[model samples]
Target: MKINWGHLNHDSAVAVQSVLETEYNFRTTVTKLFLQKLTDEMHDHLEDVQFDICPLTKCFKISPATPEPVHAALKEIMSHHLPKYKEYTYQA
Candidate 1:
């Protein structure tokens, strides 16, 4: 799965990548071509974003504290990148 890290800085991107790779067993390829086209279309308003993936359940959770715009952007990105999975949002 390809993660949209355009809005994230180096450390944040690496952290996310580590979780996806180690926990979810996702193999990612980072190329110069991919980096060149990175889009910060979400405006980088969000500072801290979290993702929890459950491969068995085929669902992933995004941090509830996230702003609506960033949340929507994340949902869209996750949906596009992980079409087979479902989003698990906190209901409170």
Candidate 2:
């Protein structure tokens, strides 16, 4: 998934980065710089960016131009981590 870790605290972001890399099989590193930029630019496009108190990253930005593999990865994440959350979304 194309996770943006900027909204989270430094340590939490690092933990998320580790999980995405090690457990989720993502090879690329998720750096603070990358996330900082994402936090800034992402808001320009998306209307709703939700944050939870779960100590993980606050937001999940699924780009309209999101690639196939990333989309698949997000699907896997939602299935495993967000089963209780609603699947349907409405754009305003």
Candidate 3:
């Protein structure tokens, strides 16, 4: 019997299920009985990997931006003049 599998390298989520899925490929559909075979292999192979789903989200949150005085004035007028949800908290 030939087993078709993909290379499961450099996992970052570090989740046991994700790692096992990478290692098992389509085995879960082939046979649930032997999924443990691949899971055992994953247990021995977990390693550090850079995780970056939204790496930009971090920079955007941490970095500050200053608008020019003219732009700020326009924003102020538009925010106050425009219709907004009652739930909006920022000052116009």
Task: For each candidate in the order shown, give its overall lDDT on alpha carbons.
Answer: 0.46, 0.38, 0.28
- Per-residue lDDT tens digits for candidate 2, residues 15-84, read 7666455423221322322234344544343233221222242233344445444445444555555554
The list of candidate 3 runs beyond 4 A from truth reads 1-66, 85-92
Candidate 1 residue lDDT tens string, 31-59: 22223333566445534445444433324
Worst 10 residues of 1 by lDDT: 26-35
How does candidate 3 fare on TM-score?
A: 0.18
Model 1 has an lDDT value of 0.46
Clashes of each: 0, 0, 0
**Model 2 weakest lDDT span, ten residues long:** 25-34
Question: What residue runs in model 1 are displaced by over 4 Å at the alpha carbon?
Answer: 1-43, 53-58, 87-92
Clash pairs for candidate 1: none
TM-score of each: 0.42, 0.28, 0.18
Tell me which of candidates 1 and 3 scores higher on TM-score.
Answer: 1
Please rank every candidate by TM-score, starting with the best: 1, 2, 3
